[model samples]
Target: MRDNIILACQTCKHRNYTSTKNKKTLPQKLELKKYCPFCREHTLHKETK
Candidate 1:
């Protein structure tokens, strides 16, 4: 099933985005290059617990 998850900016350590994922299919944590307003640039966002 799809589960809600929070994405945090790696550069500034700020929570920036929210998304969903299929936990059963993809067990690994999510990671994406997203724009962070705090950092004012595109940064690596990782899923947080």
Candidate 2:
């Protein structure tokens, strides 16, 4: 099943995005490059509780 997760900006430490992933297929935390309005640039986003 798909599980909800929060994506936090690495630079500004802002929780800017929310997404889901297949828990069975990928067990590791998700990391992505996404836009952060607070930082006003694209930054590395890491998964958090």
Q: lDDT per residue, candidate 2, 1-49, as tens digits?
A: 8999999999999999999999899999999999999999999999999
Please identify model 1 stretches exceeding 4 Å from their true place: none
Per-residue C-alpha lDDT of model 1 across residues 1-49, encoded as one tens digit per residue:
8999999999999998999999999999999999999999999999997
TM-scores for every predicted model: 0.96, 0.94
After superposition on all C-alphas, the RMSD of every candidate to the true structure, in Å, is: 0.5, 0.6
Deviation in Å, model 2, residue 12 alpha carbon: 0.9
Name the top TM-score candidate. Answer: 1
> After aligning candidate 2 to the native by TM-score, how far in Å is the CA of 10 from where it should be?
0.6
Which sections of candidate 2 miss by over 4 Å?
none
